[model samples]
Target: MTIPPGPYSPNPAPLLARALRALRRDTGLPVAFGGPVSRDGRGFVIEQLDGARTTSLLRLRVQAGAGLGGRALALARPWVVDDYFAAEEITHVYDHAVAPEHLRSIAAAPVVVDGAPRAVLYVASRSSVDFGDRLLESVARVVQLVERDLAVEEEGRRRLAAAPPALHSAEVHELVAELSQIAATVQDEGIRRRLVDVCRRTRLLAGRVPSADRSPAPAVAAVRLSPREREVLAEVARGCTNDEVAEALGLLPNTVKSYLKSAMRKLGATNRVQAVNLARAAGALD
Candidate 1:
């Protein structure tokens, strides 16, 4: 198959911002921000500058292998500089960005998705301080969360890109959807990963078929049921009580109830029975 040549569709900006915020919250860092690499995958552009007093660092671009951020991205690991101006490992490519923000110390952690550096997360301080191992460890945890989410998003895109020559049938779509729900509750990591790959490819196959031949609405149709809501509703359709749904889905009972309520609201039904009826009517369920 001829893979298309272009940037991956997953937007790392929102996730990057989230990871930065989590980093700051966890490590008590005064400033935290980062951005995705350029579309060609060569440079870093600071799109999500959080905890900044001034907008001086917003949209700051750093070339690959240039600044501290660039080096982190280029080498695919975390890099720390005790003093931003006096750091010898990196050039002053982003000095203009650093000084106006009064950042004296910083560390950059690269979030890698699919073996490539996708974003560089930075935590900084206005005063000179050491970016030590404990902070780095905390940052690593945030990076893991970010990378997990990015991998999920990329798997979604690959579903679209991997669509087969023929569009998929409704039965095929239904099978894949059910399999995904089953996979969600699995315990083994390797098995879960394989199931995810299977689900992605199955979706890719299911999407290529003529729309008319598919199961109910697209997973996210106009009267969209969120994936979680859909999962809960699917169980409810089988006469599962809220507690039962919660146990099956590995969710809190209150959380299951919340998903049920949300699903009911979205389907414009006053009760679970009515909601299931509406879902079936809309082809959102089998």
Candidate 2:
């Protein structure tokens, strides 16, 4: 399947910036630095820091299970070297990059998303104080925060895609709330716009009428729907059969049937058609 284009896809610059800001706030560390590492079809590159210099610059290139950062990515855990030259656990993949910077004490943590390592967060210090558990904890907290924000955005997108076009004002309002929350937390302009787009679409769908002469339906009160349920209802309102909805939404036909049945029961409708009509009347279908 084609991956949807999103601000979170690549270009780890924003995450790095946020990570650095958090790192700097940790009073325990005299120095901190971070960059993103990726292994893709084009190979590996450390998306360099925007405006910072260090005596020792840690770099990891395309190779499996090599160097401190690469090993962290491979193993999906944080790794640290109190003394880089003396650390005998792994081979230095970027000796050329590390040597010029005079980096000695180093720590690396994988910025994991889902079950895979997407990138690494590395911090280095000149002195050999081991960088400690405090530094690692700080990094983990920052990563969790970032991941939470991403999860919000992802959930909002899923809801928007799943929701039927005939949603009631209440359902639309609920989605708007979710979108607004996601938009507020996201730092990326592109992601923010996408959230806004979802809100606009929800508004449009809710505002529509069965006929020009008929007054626009009253808005539905705010009501939350799970992302999957919203998607199923959205397809149903668009006049799609269960099989069609399932195919479009990447769900089994039985699952789509169950979602529609559940939605019908929740909206207190007798059948699929009534469910759509009542949801519209209740202002939930927008």
Candidate 3:
């Protein structure tokens, strides 16, 4: 029997690279490297290197439970050694690769999602040094960002796979609603903006069907909506009640109503349904 690869094989290299950069910025580490777990569940091949003295560490496959990185992958936590070669707790299989770089201190943190390690991030220093709480916390924050991004990307891929090529209006609305919920939970500004873009694309995808025979959408005066107002209306367009919209967007029902009213006033809509139709016509909701 053969074991399959880890779920996170071929990890998003760009995301890992960004996180590594963040690690270096926050902790001022001399070198940083990382990669996603391999497809065969064996280990990760180092695909990124930052500030390294040599390329010897690049593309090196660190097996699970063997070296500093591997042990972090196996345990789903961070491990740091002040003296890499002298660290007896970990195996020295990678000393041949590590020693050439003159690295004496190293740390590894696993990017875990839903209890499983998906990738590993490593930082090292040429001089022996102990990592303190502040540095470790910084590393943790960067890893958490990567974990959230990976989870978001994974969910997006799954939904895209399940969606029909031409989504029905109802399906699109559901997708928009789910994306909105996900966007609300995201703390990273960049990731949140990307999610918003995905929501816009989903709406555009639903609007792609041929409409040559249908009457032109009614003319609605151009109007700009505040982000909160637009968010509330987007949920309303999905047939969500004010309370439901509030819950989804993490707002009070009264606040939701205020935003809805403000948007309706701007769109000159007589009611909630009219506001949604007008906003859709004006290309604001999409």
Candidate 4:
């Protein structure tokens, strides 16, 4: 789900940093570094560096088709160099940075999401080391996680862009309800989860929308729903059955029923519809 060029640009820094940490911990790699591709898609800057002794690799920019990472980006695959300085297969444009880092063996894994390269992850060693297929596969697995997370984040952004500016409007509520139903039918679990998250956020946005004509409802201000309760109620507001809510939230049906009953009790509602309406009026589902 690609979105048109806009002021909002996707920043994969947090995801990249988290994945790199996991990679280093799981693989025991000495050095790991990478960054998200530039908005223009020309190149990426090294924004994350783990276990790196020198700051040389940090903030270093790599162009497409220029270095090991660049080759990975261009080819849309993983690449490894046993000897960084002697690798003839890749163009050595960042030799200055690599030399100071004392990194000999380096592997680059490109994280491509939705047909676009979102970021590149690199694991390197001080001494020349031959990276095996197993090691490369491990890197690939981490890259796939990053790709999946980016896809989910991108979908959330796309839905947000498609949502009306005035989320408190009746039309927006109807739209979010329809989207929630559509999310249930999607086969991709990651995408479906993101769509459901988008619906929750849309309802929250509605509660936060400013209006001069509106006054805060006292009932909304007094009721407090726990985070889990809010989550279950948000799904219920979308008209999901207890079974459907359990499936969407990875909770048991009994747990879902318990949460609904608790929320209904707090809101003085006799049924699911009334509970949702009361929650909305109270700003609990807003």
Candidate 5:
């Protein structure tokens, strides 16, 4: 599949500002800010101040796998440093970037998709304590939310491309509604563009098809699974059994089986294996 180009322009500044605000609200850390950084590309830069005096800090460039943030991006996981100067795994690639900011304690988490790091979220504190798992979890939650929005936008594009040429008027309307909803909920500029692209394509498709004035047919609603159902389906796609899903999700075997059944029904699949395949086709497992 062709990866959609990054949408970094339209709402990135506002999104960065919101991310900074969320970091502050979630962590209460002295310096709660993060932005997308690219080794070969520009990164998002955001900052929040807690004091009356606002100070301008030096700008720093980060390379992948170098500093704390780079390491997080490289590993596609979260990393923390209690004392930046004392960390043994420290890569000096971004040391220059942190020096001017007077960064000490730092934590970073990768915003990942398809097992690749697309961006990094970082939080730094002047205090001595390491940024704990609680803070990391908060950052991860935000990243996951962003990734989900991205995924939905991608799916919308694929669906539009594959839509039947003879789609009924009601089908066209439903597709437009889905496109609008996804666009509204998606935060990433890149994903939003993909959603719009799908909308545009669907409009083009609609124009090519003859319009009918009869009562509209019921549109098929795209299935939305709960987080647990999503997780279970993901695991099932990986060849996990009910017992394995139970262990992974910390649920009873019966509960895992139940989730699988419900997921299958929602996906309109006859069995677990079929559900996994259908889910993947629907881009739920992308």
Candidate 6:
């Protein structure tokens, strides 16, 4: 569950991909696709489709209160039509688009984040069978998972946007990627989202402010330092003594000294100050 980043890489909007793949798990539905609600809340644009019958759905616009997705967004809950052409629970604004795709039965649920609709997810079957509670629950689970991912990502963006100029050089992408990975596996949406927020803020401060070895330790040559060692060294580089480093890294004084010692040994340094100097010279910390 601790998917700490091995290296920094951008976490492209994962909501689209994670939502689509999660919906695709229900083999009963041969065609599935979904997208994020626009920030303006006027509509949503489809970004991912799996086994889609027609590309017409690509970037298709679903106006609020109009189609299945729109209706779900408007209601802020899951909405399904046993037959898209006959169902009275929602509007039929997308018939032209739906017909080309030959979609008979369809279901939709809003991807709610922090109590507002962020996106809409949809699944369809070509046959006449009605989508039941079991299938609906699957869609809900996917939406919840994606919501958690977005919440964490939003925190990362906010942190990066607010970061100091000098600290901006440290990568936010890797820290966000690490949070995204861990959030993806968490089953509880609330817990996952909260965890992601903490991860983003915590990593941002650690990366930007500098630490002993540096919690997000980067690799150089083959002389690797454990994450703890890197963090310990980063604090030392920041001029924090053992007690200060221990408090900052959430370790005891002796533990902080131990990690620093380990890092120093790995860096071929005889002391804490020498280890930090060597790490900086090797581009392991900045």
Q: Ten-residue segment with the worst summed lDDT in candidate 4?
A: 1-10
TM-score, every prediction = 0.65, 0.58, 0.71, 0.67, 0.55, 0.59
| 201: Cα error in model 4, Å | 6.1
Residue-wise C-alpha lDDT for candidate 3, range 176-231, written one tens digit per residue: 66766666665555656666776677777756856653334446646988899889
Candidate 3, 39: how far from true, in Å?
A: 2.8
Worst 10-residue stretch by lDDT in candidate 5? 1-10
Tens-digit lDDT track for model 6 on 119-206?
7788888888756678877877777777776665565455555555544213443444444455445554444555455544544454
Model 5 stretches with alpha carbons more than 4 Å out: 1-16, 32-59, 161-168, 177-286
Q: What are the per-residue Cα lDDT tens digits for candidate 1 across 199-235?
A: 5566456557666766564333469778898888878
1 against 3, candidate with superior TM-score: 3
Clashes of each: 8, 21, 1, 3, 2, 15
- C-alpha root-mean-square deviation, candidate 5: 11.1
After superposition, candidate 2 runs with Cα above 4 Å error: 1-12, 27-44, 54-60, 164-170, 181-286
For model 3, the stretches where C-alpha displacement exceeds 4 angstroms are 1-11, 164-166, 187-197, 208-264, 267-281, 284-286
Go through the candidates in order and give each one's C-alpha lDDT. Answer: 0.73, 0.62, 0.78, 0.76, 0.61, 0.67
The candidate with the higher lDDT, 1 or 6, is 1
What's the C-alpha lDDT at position 227 in model 2?
69
Backbone steric clashes in candidate 4, count? 3
lDDT value, residue 140 of candidate 4: 79
- The best candidate in terms of lDDT: 3
* Best model number under TM-score: 3
lDDT-superior candidate, 3 or 6: 3
For model 1, give the 10-residue run with minimal summed lDDT: 1-10
